[model samples]
Target: MNIQITPLTEDTIPGFHHVLEEIVREQKYLPITEAPPLDTLRTQLLEQLRHHLQHFVAMVDGVVVGWIDIKPKLSLPYRHVGTLGMGVLPAWRNQGLGQALVQLALKAAAELGLNRIELQVFEDNAPAIAFYQKLGFEIEGKFRRHARVGEQYRDALGMARLLEIAH
Candidate 1:
C-alpha cells in the first residue's frame, strides 16, 4: 500500500471531514458540533497551516485514510509546547497509519521550534496509550474523572514527549 502524507488545504476539507467522521463514529465519540461549519473549518485549517499549526492528511490510493494535527500552546508560558491530535479510519487502524501520522506530527512540531509535545488520551484507551509510549511519550499526569464521554465521567491521562530526548 502506498501511504502519502500531505499538508492539508481548503480543497481537502471534505476528505478530512470524511475520515474524521468515520473515526469518530467508529469510536462512538460525539460529533464535533462545537467546531465551526465546514467552510469555517476549511478557513481555520488553512490559516493554521499557514501560521500556527500543521495539519496533515494521510492518503492511500488517492483516498484520505487519516489525519493528524499539531498546534503550539496558546498560553504565554507554554508557547514552546505543542499538542497533537490524530485519528485513523476504523478500516485503516492497526495498519501503522496512526504511528506514521504521529511521527509526522512530531517532526512538524520540531521543525516549528517546539520543544515539548503533549496529548491527552482517555485512561481507558489502552491501545492509544501504548502507542504513545512506544513513541517515547511518558505519562506525565492524569485528570481524574475529568472528561464526560456520553453520560459518564472518565479519567484522562496526560502524555508528553520532550523533543530534547532521543527517541
Candidate 2:
C-alpha cells in the first residue's frame, strides 16, 4: 500500500475525524469511549491550528488512516514541552503507520523548537508501550488510577523523549 505522511490541514479533516471515531469505538485503547460531536471537534481542531499545535496525518492511498499531534505546553514553566497523542486505524496498526506519524511529529517538534515531547498511555497497553519505547521514548513516571475507563480507574505511564533540535 502506498503511504504518505503530511501535516494536518483543512482538506484532511474528514478523514482524520473518521479515523478518530473508529479508534474510539474499538475501545481497546484511548481514554475516550465516544467521538466528539462534529461541531465540537471542528472547534477544537481550529483552536489547535490557531495555536500552532503540531499535527501530522498518515494517508494510505489518499485516505487518512492515522494521525499524531503534539501540542505545546503553553504555560511559562513548560512551554518547551509538548504533550502528544496518536491513533491508527485498526487494520493499519501493525503496518508502521503509527511509527511514521510519530517520527513526523518529532521532526515537527524539533523544527518548532520544542525540546521535549511526551505522552501518557494506559498501563496495560503493552504494544503501545513497546511502540513508544522503540521511538526513543522512556517511561518517566506512572500515575496511579489516573483515568477512568468505564467504571474503573486505570493507571497511566508517562513517557518522554528529549529531542535534539537543529540550530
Candidate 3:
C-alpha cells in the first residue's frame, strides 16, 4: 500500500472526519462515542490551522486512515507545551502509521518552540500506553474515573515527554 503523510488540509477534512467517526464508534480508544457535527469539526480544524497547530493526516491511496494533532496549551506559562491527540483505523494499526504521524508532529512541535508534549490515555488501554511509552512518554499521573461512557467510568493516565529544543 502506498502511504502518504501530510499536513491536514481542507480537502482532506472529510476523510479525516470519517476515520475519526469510525474510531469513535469503537468506544474503546477515544472518550467520545461520536464525532462532533461536520460543520463544527470544520470550524475547529480551521481554527487550529489559524493558530498554526501541528496536525497531520495519514492517507492511503488518497483516503485518510489516521491523524495526529498537537495543540499548544492556552495559558502563557504553558505556551511551550502542547497536548497531543491521535487515532488510526484498526486495519492500519501496527503498520508504523501511528509512529510516523507522531514523529512528524513532534518535529513540528519542536520547530514551533514547544518544549513539552503531553497526552492522556484510558488506563485500560494497555497497547496505547505501551505505544506512548515506547515513544519516550512517561506516565505522569492518573485520573480516577476520569471519563464516563454510559454507565461505565474509566480511569485515564496522563503522559508527557520533554523535548530538548535547540536554540
Candidate 4:
C-alpha cells in the first residue's frame, strides 16, 4: 500500500472524520464511542488550521486512514505544553504509521516552541502504552476509572514527553 503523511487540509476533513468514526466505533482505542457531529468537527478542524496547529493525516492512495494531532494548552501557564491525540485504523496498526505520524508531531511541537507533549491512554491498551514508551514518553500518573463507556470502567495513564527547545 502506498502511504503518504501530510498536513490535514480542509478538503480532507470528511475523510479524516470517516477514519475517526471507524476507529471510535470499534470501542478499543479512544475514549469516545462516536465521532462528534460533522459540522462540529469541521469547525474544530478549521480552528486548528487557523492556528496552524499540528494536525496530520496518513493517506493511503489518497484516502485518510489515520491521524495525529497536537493542540497546545490555552491557559497562559500551560501554553508551552501540547496535548496529543492519535488513531490508526485497525488494519493500519502494527505498521510504522503511528510512529511516523507522532514523530513528525513531536518535531513540529519543538519547532513551535512547545516544551512538553502530553497524552492519556487507556490502561488496557497495552500496545499503545508500549508504543508511547518506545517513543520516550513516561507515565506520569494514572486516573482511576477515568472513563466509563456504558458499563465498562477504564483507567487512563497520563504520559508525557519533554522537548528541548532551541534558544
* TM-score of every candidate: 0.88, 0.95, 0.98, 0.96
* lDDT per residue as tens, model 2, 1-167: 78999888888888899999999987768888898986788789989888889988899899999999999988989888999999998888898778878888888888888989989999999999999999999999999988887898989999999999666
Against the reference, the lDDT scores of all candidates come to 0.81, 0.89, 0.93, 0.92
2 or 3, greater by TM-score: 3
Task: Report model 2's TM-score to 2 decimal places.
Answer: 0.95
Q: lDDT tens string, model 3, 1-167?
A: 78999999999999999999999999998888789988899999999889877889999999999999999987899999999999999999998999999899999999999989999999999999999999999999999998988789999999999999796
- The 10 consecutive residues of candidate 2 with the worst lDDT sum are 24-33
Clashing pairs in 1: none
Lowest lDDT sum, 10 consecutive residues, model 1, at 27-36
Model 1 clash number: 0
- Candidate 4 per-residue lDDT, tens place, 1-167, comes to 78999989888899899999998998878889799998999998998777757899999999999999999887889999999999898898998999999999999888888989999999998989999999999999999999888789999999999998787
Residues 1-167, model 1: lDDT tens digits: 78898988777788898877666655433324243567777777877777678789999988888888988977889888988888888788898888888888888888878889988888888988999999999999998976665677778889999996344
Clashing pairs in 4: none
> Rank order by TM-score, top first?
3, 4, 2, 1
The residue ranges of model 4 lying beyond 4 angstroms of the native Cα positions read none
TM-score winner among the candidates? 3
Which is superior by TM-score, 3 or 4? 3
